[model samples]
Structures are given as C-alpha cells and as structure tokens.
Target: MKRVMGCHLEIEVIDPTEVELQVAVSGAWDDGQVVESLRCTLDGRAVDVREVRDPAGARIHVLDAGPGRLVVDYDAEVTGRARPATGTAHERSLYLRPSRYAEADKFFGFAATEFADVVEEHGDDAAVLLPYVAAWVGSRLDYVPGASGPTDSAKDTLLAGAGVCRDYSHLTVALLRALGVPARLAAVYAPGCDPMDFHAVAEALVGDTWHVADATCLAPRSSLVRIATGRDAADTAFCDNHGGGIQLHVSQVHAIVDGPLPGDDLAELVAIT
Candidate 1:
C-alpha cells in the first residue's frame, strides 16, 4: 500500500569547543524514488542540507551545525513494494564481509553447528535461511532495553542471550553472513511499534533481492519506514558527531500511517530505496 511516513528529530550539542555535527535521519527512500516531500528545519531555522550515498546506495542527508539546538522536521511519501532483485555485486561483497557490529566471521563456528540442518535443507536460499535464523535467534534472547550498548557485537549478544532491537539485528546479520548470505543492518521508523521509536532490523540478500528480518518482532515489517541501511548500526547511526560533548534533548520519531496497517500474516519484506 502507498503510504506517507516521517519524523521530527531534535538533538542538542553542548560543546564549548569547536566541533563538527553530522546527522542522518531525514531521507525516506524506497525503490529509488526520491523524497519529493521532505522538509527539514534546524534550530527553528532552515539549514542547508547535503546528500551522501550510504553503502546501500541510500541518500543520507548530512547537516552541519555548531554548538546549539539541531531540530529537524521532515515528512515524505514512499511507495513500497515486495522485496525484489538482489543488489549489485558491490552490495553483496560488502555485506558478506564481517563488520564491526555484525562479526559474522567470528560466529561461523557457532552458526555452523546450531543451524547445520537448516543450512542443509534451505542451502543458500536466503528466504528460508532468514526466517530460520530469525526464529532461532529470537528464541535465544530475552528482550532487554538497557542490556546492551552501541558498541555491543553479535558475539556479545549471543553470549548474553539478551539485547534490544540492534542486538537482534546484529546477531541475525552475523549468522546470515556466516552462512555465506549477504545481510545488512536497517534503521526504520516503526509506526505500530509498542514503544514507538526508531527500530533496527536485518535485511538479507535472497535470490536477486533484499528481504527484511526483524527478529525482535516488536513492529510489523510492513509498516516500517526506511531510515538508512549499513553494514552495522555504526553506518546507519541516527547521529554521528565528529568531535563534541553533546546530550540529546527530547528526541522523537513517529510514522503516521495513511490508513490501517497490514496484519502480520500479510506482512512481507519491503523494498527500501
């Protein structure tokens, strides 16, 4: 279904010295369609915006601001479709490699033993492999909000058996990569999410397309609005500061669905631009 999704983000940087501020939280991409309805306002005033291509080819807007309030109000109309064709060879190669958060190489031994049968049955079919991994990983962990941090790795989450959405995505991505499937981290705005905030999920290369796998299951995948894609959370971070001492003030994210959302039974992996 066609939908309009967006968010209002406000961040404050409290740095007495010189610092560079860069944020990626406005671009709503889907199937190569530009965000024709995007509008951003910084610190109650309009600020110039710059675009940069992320690893997944999504346009991540960059804003430059000094020590002050950085507020962004943005909205966009995006039409999502079924997860289609695989990404370019570069996307596959990059996602297949072990990343800082998704250390797939390190989880190779564990994944091989735990999912030996699933691998044998599904082989390299990412469609089957993804759900198998998602269910297994979801069962292993207990969702605990503050149990993990940004620097936490899949190895860390696996050992702990508990983590937030990011941890779930990391472990899932790690396992998929260990099985020789290309997977990446995806940050999104979940409209029907329980806690109502930015959510993270994993996407795997299946056939010739990318598919979403949210092990947490807190939000329906069909209602997710793509924020950014990356090798890990580091690459898809909402805010990246070059040098500064900052504190986030009243950060909020929400998606106003145009109408009723599809049920989980009908939800499918959506293609994000």
Candidate 2:
C-alpha cells in the first residue's frame, strides 16, 4: 500500500527556542520499497533538521529555530508494505507501568470489574482483551473534539466519557496496562481518517507482536504510518518547544491512500507500519 501525508505550521517564536518536530515517518522504511519523497522548510528556505531515532526506529526531527515567524512545511510519500517487528521483553517493563497521561494504576479497580469475568472465561489472553477493551472504550465515549485537555489523564477521560483520538488512545492504553498487558501510545499518519489529521492509537503487546487497538476506529490500522511511539502523548507531540513562547498561527495536516481504503477489522491483530 502507498500513502501520502504532510503538515504545515506557522508559528511566531517570541524568543530563541529549541523546537522538535515528530512529524516524519519512521526511519525504518524498507530500502527496496522506497517512495520516500520528503521535504521540510522554514520560510521557504531549507532548515537544518537533524534526525533522531528511538530504539524502536521512530523518527523525531529536531531543530533550533529563531525568534521570528517560522513557516514549517513537511510532506512525504510512504511506499511499502511495512516491516513487521518480532515482539521482545525489552520494552515491556517500561510500558506496563503508569505514565503521565496513561495513569494505569489509577484505573485498576475499574479494570478489574470490566474484564474480571471475561478473563476468567477466556483465560487472560491479550488477543481477547485487546478487542474487548477497544469496544468497551468505544461504547463509553463520544467523539467530541474539544472535550479533553492536554493535561487530562485516563481518569479524566473516563469521567468525561467523551474525547478525540488521543484521549481514546490514552484511556485504552491505561486500561490495558491495568489489565496486565504492556501497552503504549502511537502517533501515526492515518490514511482514510475522518477529519483527517495526525492520529493516535493504542498498541498492546500480544504474544510476539504488537497489535493496534484503536477505540475510535477512525481509520484502517493497517494503513497507519508510524510517526512516534511512547508512554503517551507527551513523548509523541507533533510540535514541542523547550523555551520561549510560540504562537501557532496556522496548522494543517492531510493524509490519503493511493486506492480505496482497506476495510478495518478490529478483531484482527494489525500492526501500525
């Protein structure tokens, strides 16, 4: 499958600051299936964006830009059947614990009741719990754009019972972690996403592979292009600045697939490539 995606941002930096853009596709792209036509610029000029790759190969572009109006534009075409990862215990210890937004520990009681009987009946399988958690979260929440805040945790989302993609992902990750499954948040470029923009989904470890559990089900999980993955949104924000203030004048993102979107099967264990 082929996918095209990009984002445009206009920001007024009040002071000198360190900025990082986690908007590029993962650096683990297969060499043979190369269709990666990508570019990033500031004020129509090429900016020095250094590449940083995590242990898992997600890409983060970092640059120190000025106290001026910076227009950052990026676009890329990803062409390949994404490579599959063999699951390992290396990241399990980190993902199983509660983080800033996930707060898995806070949701343990709610999780016990939600999956208690199901676990007894199905024998505590991640494959079974994955889809069940996704469906449960989907049923509880409404897809309201402004219903959640940046600082909101899984507890906050559960109380509100309404949120966008990231919120749903946060809650799903927390709940799965509470149920003893190592799960984390992934920021991806989702082709065929409704109200298209960068999307976030919950990814859980089941046996020897990482499977996506998108409660929102906004796009086909198999078509998702990985941007960044972490404990939660904090580690995968599209734009983050360390110092000074930045005013976002304009922000836009678009993504689409080459042909018609593939049908999404929540029951299937699909990994985000």
TM-score of each: 0.85, 0.95
Cα error, candidate 2, residue 236 (Å): 0.6
Tens digits of per-residue lDDT for model 1, 1-273: 565555566677576322222233334344555344444555577767777774444566665666677776666665654244358888889999999999988988988899899888877878788878888888999999899977999999999999999999999999999998999988877767867667899999886778888888887777776767889998877766666666667656666566786666413555443
Off by over 4 Å in 2: 37-45
lDDT of 2 by residue, 139-246 (tens): 999999999988998899999999999999999999999999999999998988888888999999988788888899899888888888899999999989988778
Instruction: For each of the candidates, give the backbone clash count.
Output: 6, 0
Candidate 2 accuracy as lDDT? 0.85
Worst 10 residues of 1 by lDDT: 17-26
The local distance difference test score of each candidate is 0.74, 0.85
Angstrom error at residue 215, model 2: 0.4
